[model samples]
Target: MNLNPDQVSNYVTKYADVLVDYSLKLVSAFIILFVGIYAIRLINRIITKVMVQRNLDPTLTKFLSDILIWALRILLFVTFISKLGIETSSFVAILGAMGLAVGLSLQGSLSNFAGGMLIIVFKPFKVGDTIEAQGVIATVSEIQIFVTKMITGNNQTVFVPNGSLSNGTIINYSMQGERKADLTFSISYDSDIKKAKEVLLEVLTKNPKVLKKPAPEVFVKNLTAASIDFAVRPWATNANYGSVVSDTLENCKVALDEAGISIQPYTIQK
Candidate 1:
């Protein structure tokens, strides 16, 4: 059936009213969203300041502040949409579906992010500490939201995901002030054990880096199939560990060679 011109005009006016109403509501929603986001940021800053005053870890405080702001902003957006007379249940449903898809797509990254949060909160290790984690030995350079940056002994920077790091074992060498350098060397069974001990003691006495209180230990540790093993355990500052080990090995070799002691070798047959 053909509609009359007057009736058609009336229908168009009704449609225009709905469009105008919807547009006004959308504009109001956007205004609330902008203002709410700014307010959330201000609140986040205040919370961050409070956390700092309470002596919270800076990393944890920053993370918590960000999460709080995000949560509040999301709440405000949902409220704004509801005020616009939109069915929020459908919006929430759509959001949940999209969130699930995103979460699945970034499952590993999400896990790492969660793990990073745990690390920051628990503080198993911090930036600048020498740590062994996930079979990588390096100094922690930075702790990020989903990964930890490490500088290896060879001056290589590595980014390790926090999920694997948190799930694995972490050896923090910087926790203790003093670290023991346990050196093991083998000698021929015919060598003079007492004389070898004397030579090691002399080397320890001359080294100023070695701690005097704990003192250095030199003793026969074990008798292997091919040679006798001697252990030289010494305590030194963690910073001097590499130097002490290198110097001690060089000096011990020289002293033993001068004293007519020979190092035994373990041979493997093909």
Candidate 2:
């Protein structure tokens, strides 16, 4: 059917107005998005630099920056959608539902993520630190968002979940920059205790790896029916811990053997 002139003119005006308004809104949203991206990067860099200046751990700093950037970008996207004249209340509801679904499915990962964050914030341990946790003794190689990598004494690589690590007891052997190598030596009952102690002290002091500040300790620990036990401990830098322990033990045995202080096997009957 043919339309009336006035009716067509009014319809054309309304359609043109609607198109122009939507076009402007779309353009505005695009501009906001581009600007928002640049702003997010700028903000992330500024925060990361500040954290670096404060000597925050690099892993934590990077994780924080990425999280903050993601959250900001999500908000920016939401704002852009709102500009398109879509109902945000429904959008928010949809997001909440999706979030609930994701959270339910990823509870364990979320717990680990939170655990990792707590570890970073509390400074419980850092990269290159040796920590004992979860029945494993290893040196930390890297700290990630959900897991920590460790290198064992035998050159094994282990990945530990952050959730249990943060919740469990952690023995940090490298925190003090120095470690004590506790070595025990057994001597025959016939051996003179004074000679044994002197031999051990000499052995410890001669090792260049052992620290001289704390001084090496050598004393009669306990007397067994078969032998006398001497407790010997030497302080060494963490970097020298393994080598020092091995050297001290081997040297003590040789010194005792040469000094005629016999080391005999001792047994305790229960």
Candidate 3:
């Protein structure tokens, strides 16, 4: 079992070549990793700047940028592995399986996230907007990736899932910048219809909160055994809607009383 000098030299040279190749691969992988990280950061900053310039929502901009960075980093990781001559197909298969499992388990969350993206993109509502959705009328306090935060009239905080909110009907009360307050006033059947209409119209006209362009209207809405109802419709800026309705009601009562019109009780339809 004797080994010749030539045979020993050949073994030493082959092993040295393998070591050098591995060392080179290691250095290349590290260099690509550092450079890839820097490039991801640069791209993220550029994207953020562009989004800001376009006046995109801060929350959306950050979320999108983070997603892009992570995706890029994953690609860079795969490339680094490939550079080392390691089997990447199996690694990628494992990643795909994991992603699919996670996605299936988080269906609702993913749906909500997608819905949130739609809401932010389409802008059906915004913060401070009074909206009617999911059988609740509330002012939107905040909008997030998973849910919308609202403050109800009773001061209760509500968290509505974005998945349902985006898919369901939404009434944005503030989008039009104005609102109509539909009011009904009742009087004795014996009351003068013409005079009651005049009194009611005068009440709305005198209220500064009510808009003047559309002009307020008073008309006979219904007649019942107990009373005659007058429909009072007034237009007002969204900010003044509440005050206008309340003030008009109070003023109409006083005006009708002064005019000798007998007011009666009746249900008011919203």
Query: Which candidate leads in TM-score?
Result: 2
lDDT of 1 by residue, 95-179 (tens): 9999999999999999999889889988999888899998889999989999999999999999999999998899998888777
Query: Measured by C-alpha RMSD in angstroms, how accurate is candidate 1?
Result: 4.9
lDDT of candidate 3 over 69-124, digit per residue (tens) = 88999999999999999999999999999999999999999999998888888989
Candidate ranking (TM-score, best to worst) = 2, 3, 1
lDDT of 2 by residue, 120-145 (tens): 88978899999899999999999998
- Count of backbone collisions within predicted model 3: 0
Clashing residue pairs, backbone N/CA/C < 3 A, model 3: none
Residue 126 in candidate 2, Cα distance off native in Å:
0.7
Reference-based lDDT, each prediction = 0.87, 0.89, 0.91
RMSD of each: 4.9, 2.6, 2.8
For model 2, the stretches where C-alpha displacement exceeds 4 angstroms are 265-270
TM-score of each: 0.77, 0.95, 0.85
Off by over 4 Å in 1: 1-35, 83-85, 265-270
Please rank every candidate by lDDT, starting with the best: 3, 2, 1
Q: Higher TM-score: candidate 1 or 2?
A: 2
